[model samples]
Target: MKKSYCPIDTFINVIKGKRKSTIILHLFQGNKRYNELVKLIPDISERMMSKQLKELETDNLINREVFPEVPPRVEYSLTDLGKEIHPYLKGMFKGGIIFENKIDSEEN
Candidate 1:
């Protein structure tokens, strides 16, 4: 947990899992319902989504809030620590898009 330790590896340990990083990145914008995340990442199965969300929550990268109502509701959003990753995530996404586009163009 200390920055003096192997912080980069620790960070990667939390972020590098499949669907985990993307879920956190998407949550950087705002709170999202479980259904919303599934809709956005349609290729992911419901079971996988639930698993990823649980992992992120365990890592303290996300908040899992449940509301009381006739029909219960749950929403997820980035924790403050997770919000701190926003700038980096944005840079990664922007650069990844450009890189992918270049590869596509080269292949054609």
Candidate 2:
């Protein structure tokens, strides 16, 4: 199917959305259960968080594991592609601050 987006644009779109980048950031630190992510990014609604996670999984950036247990255990971690892509996350990490603070600005 011909997409209405450039290949690069399509690639960026997969990661640029509601909260996909933030969720990936949390996972980059280490593997986490779904609840841990919710706690880390409190502003995100549960529905939104789940949706973002699924998108990342589809993009091959994350791996979701489900364990069969009485309480139903589930965990999420980054895939090899995630490690490759994490460097880009830094752009989001240091966004405004990178240019917002002037080199000569002196503020305590």
Candidate 3:
């Protein structure tokens, strides 16, 4: 990840991608196989999911483990850094709800 003048920028840069934060939040629940993630985030295309996973792995926020079997099985789990960031993400989630509610009220 590139250094930013503000730490928030760095944080945003790491998590910025289509459904990247969502992917992290899901993996925070437990280790998941690729297909499981695909199912959990049906809105995201398989190709985009793959790309986000690769980027997350590269950022050291998540671990990708591949088992050697007839057909390779891969699972994703949050790394220490990923786990550490959960509180911040949780805050964001709560803040988002507040904003969403405001928007809904305005639309009515």
Can you give the TM-score per candidate against the true fold? 0.85, 0.81, 0.97
For residue 14, model 1's alpha carbon misses the true position, in angstroms, by: 1.0
**Candidate 2 error regions (>4 Å):** 1-7, 99-108
Candidate 3 local lDDT, 4-73, one digit each (tens): 9999999999999998888889989999999999999999999999999999999999999999997999
Candidate 3 — what's its lDDT? 0.93
Per-residue error (Å), model 1, residue 41 = 1.1
Report, for every candidate in turn, its global Cα lDDT versus the true structure. 0.84, 0.83, 0.93
Q: Give the C-alpha miss distance for residue 11 in model 2, angstroms.
A: 3.1
lDDT of 1 by residue, 1-108 (tens): 323358777776677766777888889878999999999888889998998888888878899999997688999999998899777767878999999999999999
Better of 1 and 3 by lDDT: 3
lDDT of 2 by residue, 22-73 (tens): 8888889999999999999999899998988888898889999999998998
User: Which stretch of 10 consecutive residues in model 1 shows the poorest summed lDDT?
Assistant: 1-10
Model 3 lDDT-worst window of ten = 19-28
Question: Candidate 2, 45: how far from true, in Å?
Answer: 0.4
Q: Give the TM-score of candidate 2.
A: 0.81
**Residue 68, model 2: Cα distance from true site in angstroms:** 1.2
Q: Which candidate order results from sorting by lDDT in descending order?
A: 3, 1, 2
Q: Please give the RMSD of candidate 1 to the true structure.
A: 2.4
